[model samples]
Target: MRYHRLTPAAAVLAVLTLSATACSTKSGTGTDTAGSDGVKTGPGVTETTITLGALTDLTGPYASLGRSIVNAQQLYADQLNASGGVCGRTVRITVKDHGYDVQKAVTAFTETEPNVAALSQVVGSPVVSSLQQEIEAKHLLTLPMAWASSLLGNEYLQVIGSTYDIDMVNGVEFVVRKAKLKPGDKIGHVYFEGEFGENALAGAKYAAKQHRLSIVEQKIKPTDQDLTAQVTALKQAGVKAVLISAGPKQTAALVGTAAAQGFAVPVLSNSPGFAPQLLATPVAPAVEKQLHVVSPAPSFSSDIPAIQKLAKDYKAKYPKALLDSGVIGGWNAIAVLGEDLKAACKAKDLTRDGIAAAHRKQSGLSILGVSHDFSDRAKPSTYESFVHKPSKQAAGGLVNVEPAHAVPAARSYPLPKS
Candidate 1:
């Protein structure tokens, strides 16, 4: 759904209406109450239902990912509800399209904060950063879609898997091992200019230092689509391999432009840098040949039973939907929330504090065979990551080159101080 630019009055009115309809509750300071079941109830919890809010980007830079994420979450919630949801209450998701805008995200949060148990999904680093203070002030447990390392150390924010820095560290390690680079070798890193890119660059820098390699940097904005100049500069630098901390468009442009220019070298990227739809583009051959993405989730083509079931169920639900890692990400995030809710239910405390405490106690949470430990808020759930390369025949247009694992360097890399 396309969202046109709205006038201030219209935007406020729209958000109010959207929040009221989506929440189906009166707005006020969200508080908890005792339910008949002896469970502590909260603003988004009632006798029969529990609601979660999602601030996603459906008409912006990450729309492709946002759509799939929402679809998978809704699918998971529907299935859970059908099977009798946690603590005898049904699960509901109320989503707002922020279009990756900071103000829109803050507005959505303001309008919806009083009506949901927690935020199920908030896409983009900027959006997450913008809402951090509010989330902390309200003590709302939130799962962010982005993996910027800067989001770490927040008690209210649940970063799903390995952070951007760890992903880049693993990515650089993978590229180094694959390319057999020696000391003094140079690698080029093309990145964006914000939390995501800067954090990933830190990882790359750390990994390079560990391997005794030099880095050539090319920083760009998210709106910088065509990476011809970046590619050209990297190629001129005579780097042995290139790493990307940008989006799919920049990934495609870099790989395709490099191939066309005959700047043949391994290209590594963070997870969010690839999309299955790119397989249909003219850069398919180049992407398949050169691009490798480090992902927290397994590919849709993975043979894991749970993942296979998810792929089958997702296909059955949305026949025309493009298979991508976003679906798995969304499903995993909601599953994590489900775990927290179940714990809260078992403890007979369904308030925001209850949920947040429950999450801290959660450990060994598995999705796609990766164990997530929520005991540490200063670090990611895991340090391991799957390395994938594009393939036309793969269900998500990418297949794992190797099983997910954390390298020695990644294991020892320290997170940057906030």
Candidate 2:
């Protein structure tokens, strides 16, 4: 759980590895030759070309989500490059689409062999689960989009925000507190199968026990586009409220079904199930009033200086884009990468190990209004140790959530009525 800051020499090697391993698909080769000053310098080095790659779902079930994320990451990269690049090094991102399939994700990762110092925004649990071993073996640090809690224990993987478990627990607790729900309140949970669902379910169960709430119903599946059956099941059970752990499509379906069935209890969802773009779609106007989403970072409407700057720049470049979790999540991941790159370059080494070491020494750095000290020896139980905001719909169908809460991992919330 404790991370030791890398020594000067170690930092140098990490940067060196990062520069060398970034994108030599055929064989690992250093693009820059190191000089006596300990900086790698060559045509590539002088150009400050750092080859980075992203594993995105540009053409599959998650393509809509993936495209926004890729765009946001591109925006971040462009901004960084325009501002003299990270640590005086230019960053080039090579994005590969895995179609949200585990096998395809493995293929994408394999294709990136001998290249790509780090992986970002991978979309699904199956893909991440497949790549876990390779990531560890290569010491490739992963910034994941999937929020399954199981990924937290991996040393090579550092999630940028809250895990699904933390989000669910926090969400349930918040609703319970706000609703003034007491012990024995009936809570229902609906989720997809796999790690994502299990994590949320685990968190809900924990919270229910902690708060002495009764879980009246639990419905799960591998994938369901229609939630009529689940909603019917929950209604029959007479649950007080429902906690959902699902992707956008399913989440929308559940809300629609719940509304149609006249089940008006409050609904809480984890990060995966919440998307601002969903609000713009046909589903938004109807579900906006009844649904509440927990976000790991500041809301898109957040007035934080950094978040505002990001939003302004994002809109100026991509005028038609809607600011969603995918966009913000991708932006945040790339920002972390940029910060680590800056620190590594300051150390004059651009290797994987060096970057990881730099990350360890980065203390008190703020991102998206959340401050974290990676330098700490204590391993965080939940990445949500930083502040989290619950997003709700604003006037004109836009997201108008404020940054009002700072729930630590130590805090526990009551369970939603089952």
Candidate 3:
């Protein structure tokens, strides 16, 4: 929790020049680190190597995501080590599979924490929830992939993008404001029963209340694949638009099932709901017509100079892999990690505490548009998001409808109970 202001020259590499505006920041500021070389100052760090950890799900329901996150983290580390790693120390990452289970995640964290400096990517919200206490107790500065708004105030927590709750709010705002929800109309929500689903529900509920629209809810188990009953009920309920908080398979299933059942309503889904592979499936046309996604950044095809450079690098390294949300997200997470790592190294504090300190000072330095409008580390979250309409013409089948921005009442939305 301690921080020191970086010198101007150091700030150029570590801190992006923030403009004239009020914003959220990492942590409090102080002076430069004054530690000698050859002394043990942080965990998983030594004169020659720095070890990192990742808790992932390689054989579980969300295995695709877990694989993508690890691949990207390793890609980043490989590139760095090849070019002479941070502070002249080579980087190494240890990956542990939790299979998306809470108990498994805890066990993996318990074993991996002792051998690593930080956890680069923790995949599931519920899993992160399970490890939250131990992470704080150990002060392991973790940059998690799951964007649950509920994890906000934790000492070592840093989200990759906006939370699921925020993304949900953005989706709702798009329907109510731009898509034009009407009076006497209702919005229906179907979600898996977990932190991801609950956070998304919280956002949908907030938006519906604020817009004076009637809302109905349905919760589902992750194992229950057939959504015929849920879709039928929503159709019977006469809901106008549906919000889904589930994965790619369920997303396609619900939309496909709804289409087959003649309930042709638009679906607005949470970020994780869609993947590039959906476009190649049998339900491609239905998906293009009925689905829309909320995301933290522009799609992988974004022409931004930084993304272009990254895409180029990825193509050179792994030619056969198709660029999906997971791939882009993996690269993005590590890009941010690489920046903070360099900053931590420059500050001469490569230990767990020093890394946390460096993250505390990250203000406005986005690693090539991966994150925008970031201000402070302590409040490492944003209420802004963008809506992408499913498009048959676009490569990923989703086109931007609204530029990423803040909802009018976003800040007023209440934080969920601890």
Candidate 4:
């Protein structure tokens, strides 16, 4: 859902029909059986291979990120399979594109659920929200690419990094310090109207209250790409800085319009709000000069040993693909899942519930130099985040501007339960 994408009514009907066909013809037996190692195997977990599902947006608003994420996981699976995959079984991913539509995402999930042991990637906040109940009911371990706080508290849906609220709280603190915003100073927040934006806004509001700053709120829809009017309003409000919890297109629009209107100010955004390719656009100048992003993972060009290796392998495999931050996010989620599967294997139980249990037992996990704590299902994997700014010469067009750490404000802010 990247919140949501607009689709023609006809396309929705067509996808629904296609989903029905997939449901009838593509459904796997999903039967449980005993493995040679005496492991209890379930659907998608066979004697020779374990299949995972990826419900991603390949041709929608978040298509660029979706493709990047999918490709990285594919590369990881390839390497894992080559090196003897989890529990001596090869890993396979069955991917389905939902085009970022809620109904289509539901349809895709229903079609794909029967054939997979776990969901390796569900790419949108709203899409994951739509599937949470079924994920829990089935005891299916799922990794959501989205970081919405609302998606937390679900044991089945293991969010990979800092939740939207935590990232935003840290992001707000970064901006406040960089922009020298004193108490009573105002900042504008432009966000989509959904779980993703609202959750990030929660962090912003909390931080604002804590710092004695004021917030100018502008709520928009995912389909609303042009943010000229919103930019005008923030400028008129005379805000010191702007925080964005929307998509890349909206980010470009807001920053570009702000530049065109001469409303120069620091603009900070949630991770998904920026894409590397935007640096090639007319807004590149403004994006580079004014926009900063808070990411849950390392940049593609990061010099961290694991990240450098991933970058090398990813570039070798996908020579034509843009170096994207989603690759890191994708790899992180899959690596964590792989660890859980390994734990399940050691326990001689590869059932869906077994994998879920193994996930709950994981703590102090590290990937790409970020430590994750999954011991608490009610909390995010980590509060640490990397601050990034546009860099034309950097891979993914971004470079880390600050070290990864949870700011004091974020550490003290209470996470919203809703």
lDDT of candidate 1 over 47-161, digit per residue (tens) = 8888899998877767767777888888888889899998999888888889889999989888788888888899988888888888898889999898887888988898999
Q: Model 3 over residues 315-350: C-alpha lDDT tens digits?
A: 676565455566666666676667768888777777
Tens-place lDDT digits, model 2, residues 1-418 = 0001112333222322232234332333334456455764322233347667678775676766776677778788777889998656678666777878788888877776456656656777788888888777766657777766677556566666666676766676777875678998878888777787877788778777777887755566646778888889889887778888777677778888888778887887776676655665666644675677665666666567887888788778766556666667788788887787788788876666566667778677777777655563233323452223233443112343434343543254332221
Q: TM-score for all predictions?
A: 0.93, 0.84, 0.87, 0.92
As for candidate 1, its clashing pairs are none
Regarding TM-score, does 3 or 4 come out ahead? 4
Model 2 stretches astray by more than 4 angstroms: 1-37, 40-47, 280-285, 376-418
Name the regions of candidate 4 deviating beyond 4 angstroms. Answer: 1-31
TM-score between model 1 and native: 0.93
Error of 2 at 85 (Å): 1.4
lDDT of 4 by residue, 1-418 (tens): 2222233444322322222111111233345567778998887777788888889887777776777777778888888889999889988888788988989999988877876788889988778888888888877899998888777788788999998889988898899899999999999999999888999999999989988999999999988988989999999999999999998889999999999999999999998888877888999999999999998888866789998899889889767667777888889999999889989999988878888899999998898899888989888888888999998999878898987889888878788773
Each model's C-alpha lDDT?
0.84, 0.65, 0.71, 0.84
Candidate 1 residue spans exceeding 4 A from truth: 1-29
Predicted structure 2: clash tally: 19
